[model samples]
Target: MTDALSPAARLALDEAFERDAARGGFAHRGAVAVIGDDALAAAARERFGSPIRLFHELTPIPVAPPEGCERHGLVPELVDGVTLVVGELPRTLAGVDEIAGLVARHADADVLVVLAAREKNLERGMNERPRDSFLEVAASRGRDKARALIASGPRPTPSPAYPRSEIVSGLDFPIAAHGAVFAGTRLDIGTRALLEVLPAQLDAAALPERPTVVDLGCGTGVLAVWTARHLPGARVIATDRSWSAVSSASRTAQLAGVADRVDTVHADAGEGIPDRSVDVVLLNPPFHDGRAVIDDMAHPLFRAAGRMLRPGGTLLTVYNSHLKHRGALERSVGPTSQVARTPKFTVTRSIAR
Candidate 1:
């Protein structure tokens, strides 16, 4: 069956399966296993010839196991002896840290991490971070710059360092963040600048009762939390595509004591949000997709905001100064007006037409 895959994919599958088999593969395995990456999950299915359980989100949620298997979530507490496989390393340091923290949580499990050679530093970090939770860690010889890190011998459970919460002196409430969440429980310069200027522009008192607000890429829900608390009558929706981001934002809302006012949803650019329903949309749009720095990533988000916002509603955004998203904002959302600009970032307010 694997022969049908592209040559590169076949090679990847062959190498990974061969190494896994040499380590005494899943055959007769007593442990429950979880695969992180989708492509790797496919390869694992071919190798194991069984339906492997997939934890699609960064933070594991409850999933009914395949028939005859126990239910599993981020941690399969009921299952003794677990196997964790990370097929690909994430692109960002935060993402890498998140994966490391997740692997650490299952300290009692056997862990195997397969990373591409294209990222030398990531492979090195993958090998090192496991040592923090596992008592013994070993590395396999490299093949095609792809290698595996094998770890076992669980240590006494260490306090979880991911999903960390911290208080920033100026902010009204604390931020709870997962490792993969942007800014790591701290406000980034751009977000800070935007927040500084937002109150004056939003003028919550002037807004209609129960004003609907959307935080389009609500990383850790800082903007949403602040809005929900300050506006009092506002109904805030915080949305981000990353599972880790959604989980972190949800936690941030709770810690801010505005969970009733702020709702967190996992989505790609406000997909399910109804058109012309929101009174305001706050954005700290990303300039990159994966490793590629591109200005186009914000375009769709702008369009989505334009669609979701009511006539005369506002879209407040902060972005890297150099990207010059003003023109894009004007074109996608409505007329754009600059709110504030730091040397590194620009805050703008766009009104829906």
Candidate 2:
């Protein structure tokens, strides 16, 4: 692990490895895999002679593995034959469940999975979800305010439950989502709020007969598919940094029968999209970095919207009311005005100059 590891995570990793060594040296027998390219990955590389593979769901920086190691998307092949998997625990229970399932089904039967995180970030079902796939789940004693969950003994793996699909209330077609994507198949409050005012804003805006729409940070393809369905001539580009979200959004667009109009791109802040080319932008900017609620997460999307919008184009956003992001929207995109508001969320429209 990195020298910068917090005290808790350091202690948890020490305990986790000590336990694994005591249990017949399972880690030394086969390939090691790491879910994130962080401290856990560094540790695995040091102890196990370079991680066989590394995976990250959302990374703006390209993963450049050392000589022998390789980087992979969240595919089943990531864990194939791996005997030890180490990483920071995911924030969501569904994310934990998906990781557990992938390891149990694809990794070695005797594989040890060590997940560590700050104690405050750990929550219910973090340990319980791993138990569904493994025969044993144990927690390390809390130290330095960090803890770890170690799962071993794979059970008979069941069919994967990820990329789940369901029909949301307001939409005519079902949305699909991988475990890590925010809100899964359900439309989140912010997106719902924005959707309520979107049609009117689109109508009022001076858009072309066949304008190109960009769904920035599109989670599960809700806005992209909805816009494609409502505006038959409009082409929708759905973009997100998370591979899981991109995969889920692609599946959602396909299921909604709008795949031809809705294109999914795995990108950070709409990177690779030509500047000043988009006629309309839809965004429900994320506010959380891991489990910590912060306003910084939304800034990039706001700036991306500003750069992508054509002159006289529209940028529609929904955000937590308390974040008070209207000023940022104006500074980044253009003149902004509130379009709708609920107790918890506010939807705004910005005009590109």
Candidate 3:
């Protein structure tokens, strides 16, 4: 279903399914686990001949849970004595960390199999991260730049390393992150660049009174925490689709001593926020949709910002320079102006019309 899945992934999926089917269906194997939304679970169901337990980064969120499957939020321990099928979807370091954390948490799982595109850095991650939790990890030869990793024999000691915290150089407070949050605890270069310019831009005396700021896609709440610290009078809302991110953001805000000023929400975009109710929106839009590197992912975010901002409100964004989001910003929000630029990133201010 996801066109972004590489040919190698398709082959790996077929192999995994056939392996299970030959061994007599996943239902017979005990419990079955699959991460992410329905598309991936659907693919697994087609071959496994059974319902799958769905694990989501966020809980009680808008996305519907798979039918007849137990739903869990951010808890890998909920799945055990099962075969976990991981689709090659997450493309970032944080995503890899999250999956590895899941494996570590569910060390008792009968088998952990990954279908990943070999050309990506997935092989390295697959080989390394599982070693923390499993006694044996092996990989299949590459096929069409796709590979399969099978890990078993859960290690008894060494607890899961996740929800880690690190202090970044540019910020005053430490950032806490879960595996699913983008960039994990590390401050991404694009976000770091945006943070450098945010203080001056947000501090401008001409800003509206008691502004409501929304951090769209607030991975780990770096922007929200920083905004709350600098703009003391402003109300900050940090939102992300990942429940892990939402939880991590909340912790970051609290750790930064701004919990009273910031609100963390599990949401896709700024979903329930009132129309024209926000004054400023900070964004570091994701570049990929599943595994495909596409600029179209930011279009909806831009439109959401446009819908939430009042006339003359501002949307500050940082993105990969090569993405060239200027045209889309102009069309979706309003006229756009460059705020800052580095070798790899571009920061812009788009005003809502």
Candidate 4:
């Protein structure tokens, strides 16, 4: 289970399983789970035996399924109406014309498909790299299904918009971030919302006798030092995915003269920290993934906090009001509530128990 998956992927597995299982009945009509067709069928068969007729169809593609593993192919006898609009998927984004052209001329079926893998790799998906079906998980996961999950990896990473040269301003930021050079200028709204209310929400007990604050996904370390200066005894750990962001945050920390107090590290978004040892986790989380429309990369932040927060520790984050995630925030984050809000942004205070 701790295979190639990131912490985010590892954590999302159970929810995926429950979603997949609920889609297919324990025995009745066959339900196709595209992610791991072979595993599901074997499990289903083992549990049901021959008394229940579950037809499992695996697509002939070689890649693993999106939500599960694939062996050989899926059986046509398992489901009754597939909802995955393959052409609507990101894997088909480039060749959408061809994909849509095919789907436009396609027929309907009664099958359930659960696909988690996408046959496209980073290269093919980007069009710069040649297509190698052998290595492309997106191209193959359970393909031939009436209704099943299609293998599309977690949201594709958007190409960095700012160039290396364009990130020049960050060089001046004192001590600097992990790789340095990112989000250094004016505070972004997400970061701003966090700045406006995070301190007031945190009390003396929230921190340890010697507090440690992680400015998670800390683009440019604005909050890292801010927390250090305001909290006095608190040590701040600033981090981000972009090397540039790390560089800049480090500089900011040095400029603040809290260089030793605040440590900036290069990390995979929220993957940098040790699990479950933090006092307060503050984030002005990313709201957009480049030009594409994604509000937040909540899966990682939520899962990472779940693993990192000491029992009863808290995760304080800011979000735009329009994207309202109060419900999702409450569900993923134990006992969550809104701490601050403006017409544009809302600060969420969640305790991780």
Candidate 5:
């Protein structure tokens, strides 16, 4: 299967591992953990010929695993006794820290982690994050516009600091966030804009006494928990593709005392939610795919919302004004109208056909 990985990046990472192994760095018989996708995982299996464990966070469509490999869905135990980890480096510093902490806290004592990304995305802070969890951290020479970070000698770090909780101003509930969760514990401007106009839109929309609400691409369950608290009779479903996001959302709902009313689902754009089953969908779709800005990133979510909304059901979305998503919403969901706008954002309401 074709992967999103850059070939040069993957090759540089592989070369790093080979060089380390030649120097007797990888001597343990412990398991191999591949943290992102099949690209590096496949390479590890080829080199080690061992049963590898795979973990994915942001990848929506994971390729089939190699022989003797199994997918582990963020279970820390799967990382236990792992001597080597290979994968793409995450985009955020928190993500880098989390990976470092995970390996230090669970993997074998001599675990070696090789994380690679395109040279343009590398930062000095990425190197420092692993130092908090590993004794030795270094960067390989850049090759073919790609570089790899090598970390070894796990340190005794305190308990995991992820799924961080914080209370924000103007919000009643606390936001819990894992390392890779978007916007961290603070509300983004787009979501804030959407929330500003959401109440009036809900009041104007004709709906049942107990509406089924969905928060598509829910980051920290802010919208879902808010909906549940605002509408006592409503049942809210919050879904996101990232495991960290789903975990954060679940923790947010629990901390907000709305766990009974809010359900957290780890999915891609509300996938597995029945068609025409939801009364309303609150969406603040992401415009970035990794580090690249892609305006059509929300198209799948728009179509997903269209399928999940019942006839005449409403979709409330807030996005950067420059994206001009009104045309996409109208074509994907149904008739659309703007509800509110800020200097940077625009909130729109769409009615399903």
Candidate 6:
């Protein structure tokens, strides 16, 4: 097992091939296999030599195994003579059972297993027509289930960019986003309208030396980074339920030369932020995760802001015109007022007593 290969993963490949070569009759039959991750696959290719054929995602097994398969596509034939296949999905989830069955049919049945992500939350947050709470999808199957765990520590992120994301924003602030795909360039319009609606004077007189502000459901950290630039004296804290968002926010802050004034946290906004420390809060609340419509995301954030703010602190956010922010703010922060409103977004201010 090339388990302990150093910097060059090729060492693992050499080990796997040598081990396969050493085995006898059973080995000659071409002990077919599947890999745990891309790292393992690359290593194997190094030792075995390449021009290898790669299967895309999870293709169903061929009924006839393709007569003279090598003529159609060169399937690797080894001493054991079994065919090996790898999946594009780093992890597998439900309904992939058929693919798993197909892999077993082609390779070693007992060896037919899929690799999963180390953590579940690292799952990509997907939005269909994106309407409250984001429904996240892991890079591959089993990752959604968090099966690749070791004894301790945090679950790992897929390396080598298994979970690829389009970096939408400037290097000034990082926005390595995954889970959802955007067709147009730059951040979403809903976000633009929301960020643009943020009132510059909301906390001007209220804040002390560079008042701290948080973009609670910060999707791209666009609002957070922009707030930093717009409010030079402001210390910005960006928090998102999505880890991808946190990473993006951190990078955005770094690029903006405000990393010292910016902090990104991965905790759920529902659980609340560090107690009683914020002076201003900004948000662009989402209405749903995919097709399911929900309105609970802004609740905890509203409450959190009320608890964390300094007495007369302000929770500023922009919401879709269809949503009413009055009831939520009234219950959490005593009273709320509309700062700005348009067909798509309404900028509101909640005052903490």
Candidate closest to the true structure, highest TM-score? 5
lDDT of each: 0.70, 0.83, 0.76, 0.49, 0.83, 0.49
Error (Å) of candidate 4 at residue 94 is 27
- 1-353: candidate 3 lDDT, tens digit per residue: 64544565566566676666665656656555666556656665665666677665644445666565666665655465466565553555556656665666663446756545556656345466666767777776778876766666666663456678889788899999887677788898888889889878886525766889999999899999998998898999998877888889998998899999999888788888999999999999999855679977888999999999999899999999999999999999999999999889999999999
Model 6 poorest 10 in a row by lDDT: 126-135
Which window of 10 residues has the lowest lDDT sum in candidate 3? Answer: 2-11
List residue ranges in candidate 2 displaced over 4 A: 4-16, 26-28, 60-63, 157-159
lDDT of 5 by residue, 1-353 (tens): 22445754475457656866776855457568887766666666666666788887855334466677777755576578887777778888888888888888889886778888777787668878898888999887787788788888988863375778999987999999988888999987778888887788898887799999999999998999999999999989999988888889999999999999999887888988999999999999999976799989999999999999999999999899999999999999999998888889988899999
Model 1: CA > 4 A from native:
1-16, 30-37, 57-81, 107-117, 120-126, 138-148, 158-161
Query: Candidate 4, after superposition: displacement of residue 228 in Å?
Result: 1.3
Stronger candidate by lDDT (1 vs 4): 1
What is the Cα root-mean-square deviation between model 2 and the actual structure? Answer: 2.3
For model 5, where is the 10-residue window of minimal lDDT?
1-10
Q: Give the per-residue lDDT digits (tens) of candidate 6, residues 40-120.
A: 444444444432333322122231222122111111221022333322223222113223323333334222222223343
Q: Tell me how far the alpha carbon of residue 15 in candidate 2 is from the true structure, in angstroms, after superposition.
A: 4.3
Error of 5 at 94 (Å): 0.9
TM-score of structure candidate 5? 0.92
User: lDDT score of model 3?
Assistant: 0.76
**Candidate 2 C-alpha lDDT tens digits along 29-87:** 76667776555556666766644677777763365665556777666788998878877
**TM-score of model 4 vs. true structure:** 0.49
Of 2 and 4, the candidate ranking higher by lDDT = 2
Candidate 6 positional error at 45, Å: 27
TM-score of each: 0.85, 0.91, 0.81, 0.49, 0.92, 0.53
| RMSD versus native structure for model 5 | 2.5
Error of 3 at 156 (Å): 1.8
